[model samples]
Target: MSEHNEGDLFRQFVGDVKPLKQTVRGDKRPAAKDTPGLIERRRAAQELGNKEGNYLARQEHISPVKPWDLLSFKRDGVQHGVFRSLKQGKYVIDATIDLHGRTVQQARQEVFHFLRECVERDIRCATITHGKGQHRDPPALLKSCVNHWLQQMDEVLAFHSARPQQGGSGSTNVLLRKSQAQKDKNSEKFNRKTSRK
Candidate 1:
């Protein structure tokens, strides 16, 4: 082909290959001015303050009685009825009391001693794994005895059948009276830790 003809053909090819440019026009609404409702809402929210508007605000307005704020022993008195179901943690004792192994008198002393120790240790909650007395033919001697013993103990705030995860009906969950030192230490620890954190 001739140079002039080839140059014209190349120009035509370049023109055809080039893509068309596009411009986008946006149909946007104008920025909204502050309406009366919006202004009022802002004013009301600000006027309400944190304390007036929120549920937690009311809680803050009224002095809260923290778990550690009240006297442990005094608070325990009020919680005497509800504590059994409320507390679920474990306080295990290495020593086990077997009713079958001991005489009636010995068993009574053992029960008293165990309860006293629990109170002294400031153990709010503990489990007495009194075996279900499966071997006892007619009735569960240990189970019945533990129930009776717990009922008699003044220091036993409350007692109930333990959760299935925690020995189930075989064990009794016992809530005991808090000792002075335990109560004080717990309150001090809670105050120090909770306030700072």
Candidate 2:
């Protein structure tokens, strides 16, 4: 067949199909430029996040505890009665945080933030539910970390293993130190009573 006839046959087969426009494969629009304040704002945000996470230290050398072991701690000035009460789960738990599935780092950050918020809100009693890690190679790793972490916190007056119905050895009851406002209120009440005498 002649080349002209072949061209005619190709046009007939193609019909009215339009040719594609030659263009760049990707987006042609220029990248958006960040404002001067935007960069600074992002940096400040990142620094703030780091600062928040910095409240709790990621200790390298941690003492491991058994899965079934009971956790106990008390600050030097914490009364024996208060510690005992905490152990017995007599104080009402104002807040509770469960760290069952969280990583060590995640748990550390969460614990720090949660306790800080609790103290700010004048919460006296809080419970931390760190599951006894019987499945892990080093059993109760998070529990041991929680035990160590609680001791290092000044806000924690005392803590003990929770009662059986409250998660048994898998959870801990924490006694937080009274906020300054609460202490001041107590002092004011005492003074008022004494003055009335």
Candidate 3:
């Protein structure tokens, strides 16, 4: 082949390759800014979380209880017999919340919400299973927290560690105050008299 013909063939092969104008780091489009509606929605959600978190004390410190210890409480005016029933796990548990794998913050929020909902639904008896917490540094961390927090809630009329069959020291039996509707229903039941002719 003549030198000119060979050069023409090389040019034809190389013609498509061009020098890069700039090195591309990546997709360089401007960062997307959050929309105003999305920002407002996030803010509202955060506020709701804060409000709910306030219901239970998250940082308050109390002396830790032993993992094997039993937890019990009874507000004034709660009859001894009723408290005994609760201690004996005699009342049918209407609901239960298990905090076995939850962090302290999670357990706090769950306990507060659970008790509130139970009261609203007229749940007279409930169980809270806060694992022994034996592996934690403070020991019985969740159990101790549950013990203190339940004392603060007015809705909790009484509480006691569960029986062996229930959950032993790892769980608690709670007696909640009656809702207004429940109170009215009970009153009606007691006040109504049957008339037979």
Task: For candidate 3, list the clashing residue pairs, or say none.
Answer: none
> Runs in model 2 with CA error above 4 Å?
1-49, 52-55
- Compared with the true structure, all predictions reach lDDT values of 0.55, 0.85, 0.85
lDDT of 2 by residue, 70-115 (tens): 9998888888988888898899999999887677876776777678
Prediction 2 global C-alpha lDDT: 0.85
Worst 10 residues of 3 by lDDT: 188-197
TM-score of 3: 0.70
Tens digit per residue, CA lDDT, model 1, 1-197: 99999999999889768676897867965656768995675455444444342222111122222211111112335454465343443445333333444433444455565666667876676667655656554345556556656655667676666666766656667767778898898999999999998
Ranking by TM-score: 2, 3, 1
Which is the winner by TM-score between candidate 1 and candidate 3?
3
Candidate 3: residue 157 lDDT (0-100): 95
